[model samples]
Target: MNYLAHLFLAKDTPESLIGNLLGDFAKGSVKFLYTEEIRKGIELHRSVDTYTDSHPIFRASKRLIAQPRRKFSGILVDVFYDHFLARHWSEYSDVALEAFSSHVYKILVDNQAILPTSLLQIIPMMKAYDLLASYQEIGGIDNALRRIATRIRWQNNLADGIEDLIANYQQLEADFCAFFPELIDYAQTYCYQADRPLA
Candidate 1:
């Protein structure tokens, strides 16, 4: 079984392992997101930095540090989401919160083996990007490109999570429990017989 699958099985059979597994997964997921986000942020920062530095409005305003501005903006947005919104907003915005959760769950399930649990942290941000992508007012190919970049960052984070941690353990347990009876039946039918080995 995959490490994550093993982790899931361990959760029920060896509860002591849960803490280590959760910790490992969390660290791994976080590292993955940090690496990917920083890389993308740098690239985007560079591009925007170059463009804005050359723009007449930016030049006139003396805002030549476009890269820092972009980076700061992203960091601020992330801080707001993580500190203020992540835990609290779901109470008021059920639809948006559910959509974000569902999207993260889908990604986690689809890439269970490769993604770390820590990376699931960015699911909300990715959902935000998804929402932006669907906007009709954004207009032009630039919006599409931005959306794609955001998504790629999201996917990269997902892959990193799978690599670092086993996620959706509860869901996996539920799935197994749901089908356990049938599995037991199959095991009994195929692997056991009435005239079995001696006691």
Candidate 2:
């Protein structure tokens, strides 16, 4: 899952949102890295990722990408799935996509003191671009892919990954629609467990 999916799956709270993104930025043992709730949120993010990667529907969606790009199919699929979620935001959340995105950005800003350095570095650009909301547009996905490609030191065709999404758009959207509900249920269960008050 990408930023949007991860954040959406997380409990709608400041710490949960930050930890959801931390799963990407924070590395190694987090035993003392964050508060209990935040740590659980990070764990929740990883759990969601594990389930997503192993899911048959998600695997089938990865197969939708054509060659050359097939090697990076997982990455392509993650971005495409986010696009579908953003495009169909109303199906999942009553909050407007832009409004939800602003809420997320505010949470990040308010908690910048506790965020990972990696996330801190990108927070400005993320909010400025309104990246989470921008995912609703293909151009935004294309720009995101290109930026990711630039980050890799070695040569790669990831920049051209947009073609895979365009060609397999229908199937990929179907895959997302089919798989997302399952993810939501799984994440909700995780949230329930995480949210239980201490006895």
Best by TM-score: 2
Which lDDT tens digits does candidate 1 get at residues 1-199? 1112112212121221232133324422233333332222223223233443354432322321133333332222212122222233344344464454454345444544444446456445545554322321213123433433464543322212221112332332333333334423433342223342211
Which regions in candidate 1 have their CA more than 4 angstroms from the true location? 1-74, 81-95, 116-199
What TM-score does each of the candidates earn? 0.20, 0.95
Stretch of 10 with least lDDT, candidate 2: 190-199
Q: How close is candidate 1 to the true structure, as a TM-score?
A: 0.20
- Best model per lDDT: 2
What's the C-alpha lDDT at position 117 in model 1?
49
Please, what are the lDDT tens digits per residue for candidate 2 over residues 2-101? 9999999988888888888899888887878898878888888888999999999999999888888898999999999999999999999999999999
Q: What value does the lDDT take at residue 184 in candidate 2? A: 97
The weakest ten consecutive residues by lDDT in model 1 span: 1-10
